[model samples]
Target: MATCEPLYWRRCRSPIGWFEVGEPALIGPDAILYAMKKVQLIRDKLKTSQSRKKSYADVRRRELDFLVDDWVFLKVSPVKGVMRFGNKGNINPRYLGLYKILKRFGKVAYELELPVELAAVRPVFHISLLKKCVGDPASIVPLESVVVKDSQSYKDVPVEIQLV
Candidate 1:
């Protein structure tokens, strides 16, 4: 009987009885201040990480500046077989148009004079989507001479052969 009474007293000191476990829950102004400080720390860390990522991205990025009336090619799609902005499939050309820039919309965007076929698409495009046209003759490929297969492979055949 004596041992049982002492054990019951010890049990009452635990959470199984009325007593709370661990540290008491913080309340009032001190608790609010601690929470706010934690939130501020998290925000600071997030900002630092985001800025670091942006710096890495900016290193590879080339600043493209286009003036009004400059000729440029617009990227049709970034990936093969993915439909984007009216262009689709690997058969389609990666870029379209030696379109002329009609106006400059801030530093990162330009308004191009699009053809009637592309009237449905927005003329304004980001600088990343536009490639400056140097008008290199070698860069131009004759469509008639090239044949693309469904597997996205092409075989080059000579149109004519001559020995000088």
Candidate 2:
């Protein structure tokens, strides 16, 4: 029990400069003033950083929300289902579907009612992946037949072949 209580704290230099820990002088008025200054400096820096981040995010972040039964189009990323989308260079659909929001899972996530054809993909999606669908018949396009081979791969049916 005596060993637990420190008779005298041995002063040691911290790896970081401009500050020292476990020193007897830390209890002095000067040390208190120094610590307060450091805290104020840190608080000011944090405030500036937070404002900068808020401005950066506000520039690009789109605030979208959906109530239950709201129709939304899910974005199709090029990285996902590469075979189904095809390796035919740059032509790839950015968004797919008019899936309905079944339930709101969280603030930024919702459970969608995807068709039976898309059973392989997850039903829950983040708000970023969804776009609030405007009822425009001209905007909707039919997807071509691209047979999925099992759960792992997809085989795109050749629409045409040309050789020069």
Best-matching candidate per TM-score: 2
Clashing pairs in 2: none
**What tens digits encode model 1's per-residue C-alpha lDDT throughout 55-107?**
99999899778899889989876675665654445356778868889999778
List RMSD in Å for every model shown: 15.6, 12.4
Error of 2 at 137 (Å): 5.3
Please list the residue runs of candidate 2 whose C-alpha ends up more than 4 Å from where it truly belongs after superposition: 1-27, 80-89, 136-164
For residues 38-131, write the lDDT of model 2, one tens digit per residue: 6566567767987999999999999888999888988877776553533356677777768889999879999999888778888999999999
What's the CA RMSD of model 2 in angstroms?
A: 12.4
What number of backbone clashes does candidate 2 have, counting pairs of residues 3 or more apart or in separate chains? 0
Give candidate 1's whole-model lDDT.
0.72
TM-score of model number 2: 0.60
Model 1 residue 51 CA deviation in Å: 1.7
lDDT of each: 0.72, 0.70
> Residue 43 error for model 1, in Å?
2.7
For each candidate in turn, the TM-score is 0.55, 0.60
